[model samples]
Target: MPRHYVMCPPRHFAVDYAINPWMDPTVPVDPERAMRQWTELRDTYRRLGHQVEEVEPQPGLPDMVFAANSGTVVEGRVLGAKFATRERAAEAEHFRRWFLEHGFQDVTMPQETNEAEGDFAWTGRLLLAGTGFRTDPRAHAEAQEILGVPVISLRLVDPRYYHLDTALFVLSEADDEQPAQIAYYPDAFSPGSQRVLRRLFPDAVLADAADAECFGLNAVSDGRHVILPVEATALAEKVAARGYEPVFVDISELRKAGGGPKCCTMEIRK
Candidate 1:
């Protein structure tokens, strides 16, 4: 397994909020809380024997686009992501420099509409792409062409959720003998999109729409490791039965801006 995942510390809403006006000023901005949450998140992964490397954050970018800060790692190559918004354009530069310093090669940048790293989802040979939020549809098509993988494009219905990760995550089996189980927010996808997903993975477990809104049905990592909000205990029980140990993190501050465990992480090179 490739080591090291990149993460940036939130600046306590001190940066310019022009990129995301939806951020409520009424929410108390506490750097200490932000630091504690970041540390807890990083430490959780570290406890699992993974190195958590911290990345320097750009001065004025929106925190919601943290998922777009870098591309991804594939067989030792670090692909750079092109940011769609002007606020995020500088992030790709940092991504390139970080990969080079770390001795990773084959850095390829997507050519279309500025790529958003979060748009790229790896499921075996199928690279599903979620478009219409920050990621453009054109980039999705180009990525499939370049990567030589079938790109399943899922349309984003809610801007608050932003990336597909906010609403969906794949929970693959630990061994080849077991079937792959996908956890996704049914409400997040359109009617046709839901049908497509069901056809693709007929055994996919449908996360309740209400639970999904609670960020309970998001990404569940490891065989028994799942990161979710503290409020999702009932949902946690359902997943626990599937052998997943739900790791609850208090994301109340982060949720004010509409994000949770899945939103905060970029599973690059996993």
Candidate 2:
């Protein structure tokens, strides 16, 4: 099925500050390489028959390229983001304006601190919300109210997988032809959360530490094609084995700031 996605070019992307475990300011980031990788990802989406929309990248906000944190949109309704850190506080307004200008009438800026899709994964039927890292626990309720979906709270245990998008992703949403599915790293979540996931998605693709560290779970799936990091070879095999085509893209430059394919792409469901 074709999907709509929003992406920001990595024109000014860099790991200037250490916010996540993957970010190392000392490590040099090649802006040109990042742009190449981002463009390839966007082009790949277009090739797959998905609609790709660009958000103008702003200067100084190095992490602005991780557009998935912008907001959560479902059925034409949007729940705007509220970053937990001051470094990314301004990104919320940029994304909010984009939604309004794009003719999204119901855009609500949340009072609670939530990194939007960075910590929220929509499963068609409900929302899987993450906390104990970037997003506040209260934001789960706010998302549930604004998006009008049942929100399941999952607590993150690892700093490396700070955002839910880094640790988990929806593989395919429930439709008349298939059931909702997901892929995730169990160790990234608390024991209870792990149990919840096990019960909810018994057939979910489970990634080992090696694949998770490679940002394997940070993937985007349009029900058929799963776009993921090229470094996650093992996870790609698993994804392919599940009858979904695994498309790889090397976003190593962007990974310097703790983002992968899913982190750079936000699915807009209408």
Candidate 3:
């Protein structure tokens, strides 16, 4: 099925400060390369019949390129983001304003510190929320109430996979024809959360440390084609075995700031 997505061009993308484990100020980032890779990803989505929308990049918000953190939109009702870090706090209002200006009437900016889709993954049936790093656990309940969906809280144990998008992604949403499927790195979660995941998605694709480190789990799926980082070869093979067409795109420049395909793409389900 075709999906709706929002992406931001990496016009001002840079690793000016270290936020995540993947970011290093000393490491050079090629903004030109990042733009090329981002454009390719956007074009790929367009070629696959997906609707792609763009948010104008702000001058000072370099991390705005990772638009997935903007918010979670479902059935035209948007739960706006509240960034855990002061650096990204301004981005929330920009995204909120975009939604309102773009015909989204039911937009709710949450009071709790939540990085929106950075820690929330909707599976059609429910929301898989992550905490213990960026987002606060309290935001899970707030999202559940605002979005009118069940929110399952998962705690992250590793710093590298701080956001849920870094460690897991929904491969296919639950529908009348099929149950939701996912791909995730088990080691990123706590033992209890890992157990919960195993119970819920027994058939999920599990990524090893190697692929997870490559930010392979930071993928975007349109219920068929899975777009991921080209460096995650092993995970790509596994996804392919499960009947998904793995589309590779190199976002190595963006990866310097800890983002990949899913990080740049925000699915807007309406």
Candidate 4:
């Protein structure tokens, strides 16, 4: 069974409501709002037939996002993350307890780079690491060393899109015979990144900015299930048109703090 893992709140990281310069002050940071959105997101996954494992946050690790930054597996492992932000440097320390409590062994940290696992993706074969922002350039080599996976690291050139998952996602076909689809933002892919991807996927689908902002190509999964922001109607339409059911829920509260649905949720077991 597929497992959707999430970290409960109060354990979440939020720039001090007073110091958050990203959003307009007029925008409220009501705890109720965040809870409502997070609850809806959790329920959506549960309703989709996925086993939901809402992990409790560890003490001193105030960031719920720390769960996503670390890599996890349903029956095997739950590796902790090495965060780039000093404020979040202690992010992975709690994993030792969580892993022990959950009975997962092999939960280890990657090499010495200040990088987050959210900065990478496991494509069943190779691991793609995103450079810049939360992950440093040298960290890619470390991922290869620690994860023991063939690693291909690409640099993200835009600040607007902090992670590679923000602009690139993979879609697998329902029919076992159909080839998997890779959707990506052409504008967001720097020349070097583009070259790297081209070498990896010779026929990847290059999506436009409209789709990127719409969240249309930002997420990739089965046609029956897609993960995206509730407000991304254009993206929803495309998914629906492709004969998939889209579960929409408000995560506007998290977006104010620099994350969306994808950033908040990570798949643990497939």
Q: Which residue pairs clash within candidate 3? A: none
* TM-scores, all models, native as reference: 0.86, 0.98, 0.99, 0.81
Tens digits of per-residue lDDT for model 4 on 38-81?
Answer: 77767777777765566666555445543566553433555456
Task: Give one digit per residue, the lDDT tens place, for model 2 in 1-270.
Answer: 789999999888888899888999999889999999999999999999999999998998999999999899988889999999999999999999999999999999999999999999999898999999999999999999999989999999999999999999999888777679999999999999999999999999999999999898999999899999888999889989999999999988889899999999988988
Ranking by TM-score: 3, 2, 1, 4
| Candidate 1 stretches greater than 4 Å from native | 1-4, 11-15, 18-22, 62-69, 114-117, 173-176, 217-220
Model 3 TM-score is 0.99
Candidate 2 wrong stretches, greater than 4 Å: none
| TM-score of candidate 4 to 2 decimals | 0.81
lDDT of 3 by residue, 1-270 (tens): 789999999899998988889989898888999999999999999999999999999998999999999899988789999998888889988898899899999999998999888899999898999999999999999999999999999999999999999999999999999899999999999999999999999999999999999899999999899999988999999989999999999888899999999999998988
The alpha-carbon lDDT assigned to residue 46 of candidate 3 equals 99
lDDT tens readout by residue for model 1, 1-270? 323566667753333443443356565666667667766877877787666666676666546335533675544555578776785687778768876787765677877763444666666556667776777788777776565657798887866556777667766632357655667777787788788888887866667766776766545466457777888777677777777788888876666555566556655563
Q: Model-by-model lDDT, in order? A: 0.65, 0.93, 0.93, 0.61
State each model's C-alpha RMSD to the native: 2.8, 0.8, 0.7, 3.5
Model 2, backbone clash pairs (residues 3+ apart or across chains), number = 0
Instruction: Evaluate model 2: give its TM-score.
Output: 0.98
